[model samples]
Target: MNLFPINAGNLKLDGGAMFGVVPKSLWQKTNPADANNMIDIATRCLLIEDGNRLILIDNGMGDKQSEKFFSYYHLWGNHTLDGSLKAHGFHRDDITDVFLTHLHFDHCGGSVQWNTNKTGYEPAFKNAHFWSNKDHWLWATQPNRREKASFLKENIIPLEESGQLKFTSLPENDLQNNSELGFDIFFASGHTDKQMIPLVKYKGKTIAFMADLLPTAGHLPLPYIMGYDTRPLLTLNEKEKFLNLAADNNYYLFLEHDANNEIITVKKTEKGVRLDTVYTTEEIFN
Candidate 1:
């Protein structure tokens, strides 16, 4: 099995929204904001090459949205989904599975693209099966008022329309065991309903894809939850349990939104679970 870090572009988001109630005095040190108070974030995706399957976990925000739409997020950087794939000697057509941690635009937007004729949309990964659990699929499709903005129809509906959408057959509360994709999925609800965090066993270490649950190493503390979460209180409880489990097992956390830090390890400290060491994929795997 081979794992690759795919750079899917970068964007800026309000630091206040990203850090929730955590004071700017605290989060700003780790993720220093610019004059507009927006911090740089990476739409970092993961690529898994195992035997016949090449699976991509979260393809990042795509370029299909209008300039006005992207302006809100302050999109920046030259990294793109297609360009990143080509850099690794691969292409969108080579992906056999797209394991979405959740249906948020930044995570799944790249899953679909505008067709050649520009008449309609189509699955971006022509040969891939897009993965989302039944609960998350339902939650995203029938989104509540709070999360409605994040779940865009243009980024989602096309996958189902193209007949490439598939749901993990796991039970609602199941947070253990691997899905058919060969990675154990932990269901987290605090961030959004049934956000599946893949626990991948690779090269004698467990790599947890920290999709929004733990956006960056700065978010390691229990109270550093995102304000965008539908249920902030629920997030606290879920994060506590997950971080402890991660620290106890010595898991390598693959961060999705962190621009500077790629992978992080946590250890139980007097204050709580804290960042232990940082590593590049090459540094850790080598």
Candidate 2:
């Protein structure tokens, strides 16, 4: 199997919110925030090429949102979904699966887009089966007030309309338990309901797509949970358990939002599980 890093784009978000409860004095060293308190984040996605199936995990925030809405996030950088795919000698039509970690705009927004001439909306990966669990699909389609803003209808409905929306259910734990998809999925509810984290076996190493579970390497500490989570307390428990499991198994965590650190390995520390080693995907695999 072959893997490629697909950088959808970069966007700025408030550092305080991204590193919930953690103050500027601590996180600023790593993710230096601007005067307005916003920090640059990478909407990094992953590409899996296993024979004919080319699966893309998370497409990053798309360009469909209005100017006013986008002004808040301040999307930056030249790395786009198309450019990233083309870098690997591929295209949107070449993708066969859009494996969503969840339906948040930053993660799956690039799954759909506006057609040319502003005619209507359509699936960005025209040939891909956009995958989301049944529960996650229901939660995102019928979002609560806390997460309503992140789940835009334009991004969510078009996949189903395109007849490419398929749920990653049935076998339930499709990744870990079923030995399907070349990874085991670990479910976490603290960030959002039914957030799927793929534990992929690539090359000879076990790598995990740490969606929002640990957005950045700076968030390695258990207490560094994001405030945007619906349940902050629940996040603490989720992170502790997941991080412990990651450490015990020696899993390589691929950070989606971390602009600096691509992949990180953590070891148990007295200060509550500090980052043991930091490296790139190439180093980990090679």
RMSD of 2: 1.7
Clashing pairs in 1: none
TM-score of 1: 0.97
Instruction: Give RMSD (Å) of candidate 1 vs. truth.
Output: 1.1
Query: Can you tell me which runs of candidate 2 are displaced by over 4 Å?
Result: 170-180
Residue 219 Cα positional deviation in candidate 1, in Å, after optimal superposition: 0.6
Tens-place lDDT digits, model 1, residues 97-187: 9999999999999988889998999998999999998888999999999999999999889888888899887654647676489988888
Backbone clashes in candidate 1 total: 0
Give the local distance difference test score of model 2.
0.86
TM-scores, each model vs. reference? 0.97, 0.95
Lowest-sum lDDT 10-residue window in model 2: 170-179
Per-residue alpha-carbon lDDT of model 2 for 95-140, expressed as tens digits? 9988999999999889888899888998988888988888888899
Clashes of each: 0, 3
Candidate 2: Cα lDDT at 195: 88
